[model samples]
Target: MKISRTIHMTNSGRKHKTNKIKSIYNNMLAEFKRGEIGYSTIAILGQSCLGSIAVILLLMNDMPTMIKMVQLFLVTVFCMAFNGAVLAQLKSKITFDLLIATILLSACVIVTNLV
Candidate 1:
């Protein structure tokens, strides 16, 4: 709760971290209220999954659309990966959101590559 230790700064630093956590919690609650599963989570996981599917389709017959889909998926994967890395340094809801997205992306890439 309080995080009583002054590891970084004094009240100012602790206050910032506490605020960051609060913001994250609020964002999570807002997502729940809107009946949304956190946009970041959806984007990361969805794009990756789509990419994997596209790759599979490409391997099956190499359709033209598959190429476009793979390109789109790759873009999304890269964007989400960058966001995840940034969030890894932040103390906010985005961190969890990004982490989930990273996992989804990794899973999709691995599965699709195998396929």
Candidate 2:
């Protein structure tokens, strides 16, 4: 039936989109590993600044104490992980991945605080 055909087409389209995103992500990771996209110093500083800002925002927010503590713990863990990556001199890809994750997590926290 036309409805079944449409559903199948939609599923196919979703798969295609997902594959495209994955391909793009992989390409970016490759480029980062090759030292073509990010700098270690900048990423380190960014992680530090963003982490501090996230902590400040979390503390200033009117959220419940338990929720605040949980978010703070996550932020601290992420920051520490990034620091550990630098201290351990891990590969560029791993360090960059952690930096990106830290930035994203901090951005989420900041946005949540503002909104």
| Highest-scoring model, TM-score | 2
Please list the residue runs of candidate 2 whose C-alpha ends up more than 4 Å from where it truly belongs after superposition: 1-18, 36-38
Residue range 75-95, candidate 2, lDDT tens digits: 999988988887788887788
For residues 1-115, write the lDDT of model 1, one tens digit per residue.
7767756645754534458787886776566445434654565466556655645544565347766477547646665564655445444345555555555655655555456
What TM value does model 1 have? Answer: 0.30
What local lDDT score does residue 48 receive in model 2, on the 0 to 100 scale?
90
Instruction: Give, for candidate 2, the lowest lDDT window spanning 10 residues.
Output: 1-10
What C-alpha lDDT do the candidate models reach, one value each? 0.56, 0.83
lDDT of 1 at 107: 60
TM-scores, each model vs. reference: 0.30, 0.72
